[model samples]
Target: MTHPPTTAIRHSPDLEGELRAASKVTLIGMVLDAVLGIIKVIGGVFFHSQALLVDGIHSFSDVASDLVVLGVMRVSRQKPDQNHPYGHQRIETIGTMVLGSILIAVGAALAWDNILRLIQGGADQVPGWPVLVAAAASVIGKEWIYRYTRRVGQAIRSDLIIANAWHSRTDAFSSVIVLVSTLGAMGGFIWIDTLAAVVIAGIIIHIGWKFTWDAVKELVDTGLSPEDTEMLKAIARDTEGVRNVHELRSRRMGHDILLDIHLVVRPEISVSEGHQIGMQVVSGMRDALDNIRDINFHIDAENDEEHPPTSEQLPSREGIRNLLDEHLGGLPSHTRIRLHYLRNKIHVELFFESPDDAPGLDAEQITRHLQGYPWFGSLRLWFGAR
Candidate 1:
């Protein structure tokens, strides 16, 4: 009934702006990649170097991938409507997978072609100092492009941009091999060009496989690193209004994070008080990370201890409701509350105005004053409570 995702905090305006800028940067790279690809393709066709031609094809694929990123970004920005509830964040990840898959395919093709040529004992020789110079210039340019793109992607936490940046890096490395092969062909060693081509293929294949692995894992709903999960869980547990946390799942969508956490509070907690606590947890999580955008905290009451003594007191519904009223006394009457039982766990839900409103704070100094009460299991938060 509930699932928590590998979620991150909402991004700041600067972060959002940064991501948008990243998309723009991708378009720029796409243009550059396209131009370079065309040039290399023509040069390779005339000079007859399979390595340069393959590199050109790789660049062409990058242009296509950049287009995918642009499309995904545009769609992802559209506000969620009736057709989609969780927002369109995953579309960005889809872009990354598309790009990664393309890279891998290009790499495999290059590798296959080289293997075939080597087996046939035949390879073309493209002679001239101009080709080598051009390749060296391309290598330098591409490497710089890689660094620029990579820095922006990391700063903005954009997986698509990061993937695209690495694509440039592969291109740069591939060009280096191209340079070597060009020089080797002129040095009277024909096999050197073939060997360099093979190396270039190997490099491309490695980049493709690595990029694909990251993209595919996210597409499949894999959790975040164990360390990050533990840290997030700890933050939720220690935050006010969350008695216990469960069903905590975290998953990545490109550079973004989505989270769903079940929060536990005392069963007697009022709608206002539980909502307050949920808000606190959300704030805590938001404060903990810079990338989190949404928090879905499901507030519920903690169940009573197992094997309760016959003489021990059990909270009455009226008493629980009274406690909730006392905690959330200032809230408007329109607030709604829900009750649920899961695996014998008792929980009470309270709809509050906003998590930021601390109604009972006129009486307490600490953040978590009543999370230990027995009437609730957890408290979770969601924006625009209905």
Candidate 2:
């Protein structure tokens, strides 16, 4: 785990630029939702249209939900630090939870209002065509918004935006239903509009619950689906020097994935060599699934006792960092220092592959011995080995 720094790597400038563009699209979505919600509500009321009101209420919540998504996106862009070593990407998931809750609240509130209207015989009013036309306009506009957001979300692999994109489309869906009811009510059947409102309320409730439960699952660190797990396995197997990929664990933290795996290499290979192989494996995986931001790949010797000696093959400390990076979820070793005072003290910070199936030898005992070197001073260490 305690290794030195390696060479530098660069990010794709085009990709970075595209991601920034995505943020702007999300902001536009938030503004549109708010404006559309207000227009529908005012128009619906003026025309005595239940369907229009239902659509308006549904769109209204979209504004709040999009605002939540934008907030999450803002937090997620922050760089990783001590407090959030894994970065703030998962904050997007928390945002999703809040958005879901808001949806449910608004949907339930509208449903309650509909119930009140039914109880008070509010369905007796005949809905007007003007309001129905407004609902149709809203439906078309929101559907366009959904299309734009969805394209951006998919290209960037943003789950929050994707979910919100569908949410907007749901508003459109409700508006379409409202349009139908308003047209039906022109035939002197007022209950048609009332029934449509009730149905629209049901749809909103269902969508809200879906988002709520999904976000809750992510917050709890739910495992990746079977499909993705298999895909990762295939990725590891195809990598050079990886004998097998085992203990492949995956968890969804918001839109990002935290994955860990054990890559078995030839036993007797130096720890540094094994780590190099692990890094290669991780690189392959990233290419396979661009959505993955964190990956922990533990390198293990295959048939250690039967393999040849690896002591002479190990690379120097300078090269160890690159070799061991895969174990730290692709993060390079932080810092390695040698303090020469009355005694030799090696202060190194590092991360190791800590998985249940591939637990390495004791880490604490090695730190104590390493600190006993001739230049040992104050020992600062973050020890992890696999």
Candidate 3:
């Protein structure tokens, strides 16, 4: 038997608040990136600092990425619809990948331009002191934005936002490189500025690759870590009435985890008891892991993982009742009948209101006759109040 999954499409209570937080931070970063991008680019051209020029382009890339983050946050927070029952969380993953791609392209183009200039003889003149001031301002501003964005991302448990936060940090790091290279140029080594631009490009490409790969893993439905999977299994096994746990699977949907497991219980337990055990397991898992969004569980009379499933041709309840009637010369009226299908056979239990109802039913004779059937396992009879 399988417990139906809980209503899986409902939105979290704090989704609106999370969206607002994400949007507010992203907009703030965008404004900063635009202002810095303009300042560093114009300053690089007038002051003759190639490193500053590249850092300016990197800031513009941040502006574009911030825009992507804003759009994705809005779409990813949307409620699950009829066509997409799992909600739009994967949209955030796609958006992150796109942002990474943008970084890669921008970094590669800038790096290639600087390398060409270096090959053909570096910059004609040393950069002016104003480039130092622009780079310094970028370092301070980008660092502040990085800290702010990271705080919001952690609060919301958003991977996309955190990845964007690191993107901002990278900008700050690149600006630091610009400052060092500008100093070296002013001290009579102009080659350092062009070389620093190459180094900054490499940093951007490395971060871009990490973000892209992480998103790809999520999109492909990667399972949780081995430690986490084992912890979940331990919780299921600890629940009372559970004989064993198997087939525990998990995947991520944005910041939430989706899980399903198979639970084994005593073969004779009532269906209600089995269902209750499944519920307990679900509750236990949720208590231990806050990110679990949904769990689907299957209740088993026997461990299907260790034993072959009962054949489809095995008699169902109606068929078994009919067979019993034919072989027993009409079964006595019973208050309830329970059937346990396990290990490729059926065990039957019948409860009668009183002994008189069964008349002279011979247990040995009935057993002898039913044992001839391929699916027969065992039988038990109960009389009096059941």
**Best candidate, lDDT:** 3
Please provide, for model 2 over 227-260, each residue's C-alpha lDDT reduced to its tens digit, 9 standing for 90 to 100. Answer: 9899889988888877876568788765667787
**Ranking of all candidate structures by their TM-score, best first:** 3, 1, 2
Report lDDT (CA) for all predictions: 0.68, 0.65, 0.82
Q: Could you say which candidate leads in TM-score?
A: 3
lDDT by residue for model 3 (30-120), tens: 9999999999999999988877887898899899889889999999988878988778889998988887777677668768987886688
Estimate, for each residue in 1-386, the C-alpha lDDT of model 1 and write its tens digit.
Answer: 22222233344335347657777788778888888888878777777776777778877877877787777777765566688655666777777777777777766776777677667764555555656665776788788788888898888777777888888887887787777777777776666666666777777777767777877798798987889888888998898657788657777765667787777676555667776777788787777776776667776554324323222254555565566666655435665545454444435555656655544333232214335565445554333477
Shift of residue 306 alpha carbon in model 2, Å = 15
TM-score of 2: 0.67
Please tell me which model should have the higher TM-score, number 1 or number 2.
1
Candidate 2 colliding pairs: 295-329, 343-375, 343-376, 344-374, 344-375, 344-376, 345-375, 345-376
Each prediction's TM-score against the native? 0.70, 0.67, 0.90
Candidate 3 C-alpha error for residue 158, in Å = 1.8
Clashes of each: 36, 8, 0
TM-score of 3: 0.90
Better of 1 and 3 by TM-score: 3
